[model samples]
Target: MSTSRAPPVFLLVLLPFFASTAFISSVNGAAHMTPETSAICPTCPYFLPTPREVTTPEGIPANLTCGVRLLADRKVSWIRRKDLHVLTTGDFTYTTANKFRALHLPGSPYWSLQVEKPTVDDSGIYECQVSTQPKIFRRFTLNVVVPSAAITGTREMFMKAGSDINITCIVKGAIRGAPVTWYHVLPRPPYTEEEVEEINAGGRGGVQVVTDKHAGTSWLLVTHATWRDAGNYTCAPVHATPATVSVHVLDEEVPAGLHHDLHPSEGRSSITSPPCSTLLTVLLLVLQRVAAVNEHGHWCSFCLLLGITSCLSLTAVYTAAGETWTAAQDLSSTWSVWRL
Candidate 1:
């Protein structure tokens, strides 16, 4: 006999132990929202619309922007959490540094920090705070990357009092903000980097304040370089680490170097020559050989002259003799070369 029985509730207590369990959810349990749930798009867990990523400024007068979704009300007070620096409180804006200015856009929820051509000392952190449900505060790590003083273009010199030589100091990119100061070392380099650097790069060497593409690039076009322009040149690619380049001008530094003399390892990418000398020499030799052959073949010239004279004489005789022969033909029988 089989007995059907429902298990006791106490006995079913073991059921939980036998069943599989899910993982423990973290504090942020709201997972990503799929597009299928279009209505919840705005309130999606991962729907934080962060501001665009901005690179470190290489110069002064930088713009830092913060995004706010109609939430950062007048109660907006900026408090930097990283360093615990209270930036703004109530309607009062406080900044010890005179260069910082906060600008609130009209009709837009974007506030920006306009840093007045800041310097290496002005680099720091900035926080954008908005009084919202979660008190939305964006922390932006601000850094002013002073560009490395790398070579931009060089000033190479070769002059015959009025010959041109190009020395290009090729640097990476124009660094906005700081002005590039060009300095030159007189006499020669002192076998040291510190010796090459000048106290005021902008003072000497015909101050070329690069107003154009200052951060990444700049060029000095020197026409007809002379003996006075040869020295160790400097390119302050970054104001902090002003780079230096040396240009030596030679009176004989022109484009009049031999093609074959170019070192194979020179890495110069060019191949060109007029080939006038070689072509002229070959033509002269051919003309001379032709003239020599003509001199050696005097008999050929004489033969050609004789043939022409003989042809003329034969033609003359044919015209004159033909008439007489025609008449004589009646008297006698005759055949001539011209008639044949």
Candidate 2:
């Protein structure tokens, strides 16, 4: 049994070195993967650290923020996706439009592109780009929603004269307690700008503007509705789309055609009369029949009276003779002759 040989020296020496090297490489790789280590790296600037969507109201400024890390020699800019228009570049500079500016907040590592007084025209996709070696970018969508004022009542309202008119104006996507103004626009189309201007300044006669504001809504009360008040009323708020409603005042005197009982399907009402000659003939026939029946009854009664009186006198004589007599035949014959 013999002597066991030792392992090879080269293999024994290389195995430990390889194991140590693998352990060191794994540690270094893990460190590089960490967020803190990634932030310290100068070349990689994280563009966005928040949500990629932004919504703003019309006529208000919108600020889209971008995260910049160690961007000393790098250039940051905003580009519109629809037109590829460069809006802002670097810090405190605008590249395309006058209303856009790129500014850095004090003591912060963030850059913002300010869109002043943005409107629906400004709604689109935007990109924040970093001028790195490989060109890094982040996308954002901007939606400019216009706050609107809507009248909740029917578009055309029916009201009798001398009645109260109340209209509700609901504000959607507006700040709470926003003021809504009511205007009485002319009923006819093609209203002049001068007339609108005058109404905006102060209403004319028969036009009263009363507004009460509540949670995201406004109530307009017009007292004593009249013919002159029949027109288009608009609920308008500052820098928002206005809503319109039509007021129709009913006349005091109803139409002659509609004076009768109203039929659901028919617009007007009417009464039908039977033929005059037909009704008169029916009435005359009924009267003649009643007179004939009365005359026949009188004749029958006279016959009965004669038969009874004569029978009673004859019955006294028959009783004296002790004779039984029945007057059935005599009474029947007498009545029949009198009827003829």
Candidate 3:
């Protein structure tokens, strides 16, 4: 009777064991036999595979791609680092907030956010996030470079002493209202180079700065060129690279020492010789001496000999003067022309 009363008490213990065995068997079967079964699939964490850093020019469209592997139904997003503003989510872009759109090719596991008319303000860190049990994220840095400041003139400029010099600096793709400054830069003297002092926008001594704010342009003007003005001039913008130009001031005549050193093939001679008038004056003097000799044709032999010697000396001087005149003209022609 006792055995009958406790009959099948073991059945209750065996029932749970059988059930667990069946469940584990099903799991093993699905894992090994039914490879395409989703219920038994092992989970793999989502990941982003794109460049961590990107650069683009201003005023152009920029696209930041976020590619994922095994991300199955997880959401993708882009956020601004500065403000934490969400830019895109799962192929949807917050267009009203930013000129951006999320793009996903059909049946593809990758997506991208495109920004239109990117500016300096748009440069910074951005985050791409995946919505999961434990959220996964990636950070991307975007750098925007504005076009460098450019001085609208020849790199090498020449100006005569007492002449006015004007140079313009133009900037493109810079932030609005960014100030541009003109600086005078001089290379350090001789062997041990030193840092040269920079003279700022208001003009140093005889230099003057005129800025057109709306046009993004600045002018560096020298009222009267002098030896002091011959150096390096730079147009530097607050947001861009500096543009440099060289200034060379020429005197009315080339110095004798410089003239002797210059080769005929050299680009420019440091010294400038006098203009055409000197040659003309020499010719006139020679003609006057000949006229005196002709007016007194019956003069004494001694007087004649002195006159002949004077004429020969004048002719020699004239020949030497001609050579100097030609060299001066060649040097003058090679001087870089300064423009307004």
Highest TM-score against the true fold, candidate: 2
TM-scores of the models, in the order given: 0.42, 0.47, 0.37
lDDT of each: 0.47, 0.63, 0.63
lDDT of 3 by residue, 121-160 (tens): 9899887776753455667788777768888859988788
Q: Give the per-residue lDDT digits (tens) of candidate 1, residues 78-161.
A: 554456766664335586866666777566655676667666565666666554333445566556665565554443433455
Which one wins on lDDT? 3
Q: Which window of 10 residues has the lowest lDDT sum in candidate 3?
A: 26-35
Model 2 earns a TM-score of 0.47
Give a tens-digit lDDT track for model 2, residues 200-233.
Answer: 3254444444445456677666678765566678
lDDT of 3 at 238: 73
- Alpha-carbon deviation at 161 in model 2, angstroms: 4.4
Which residue ranges in model 3 land beyond 4 Å of their true spot?
Answer: 1-42, 149-340
Please identify model 2 stretches exceeding 4 Å from their true place: 1-44, 47-51, 57-59, 69-73, 92-94, 117-119, 132-135, 145-148, 161-164, 171-178, 185-216, 221-230, 251-340
**Better structure of 1 and 3 per lDDT:** 3
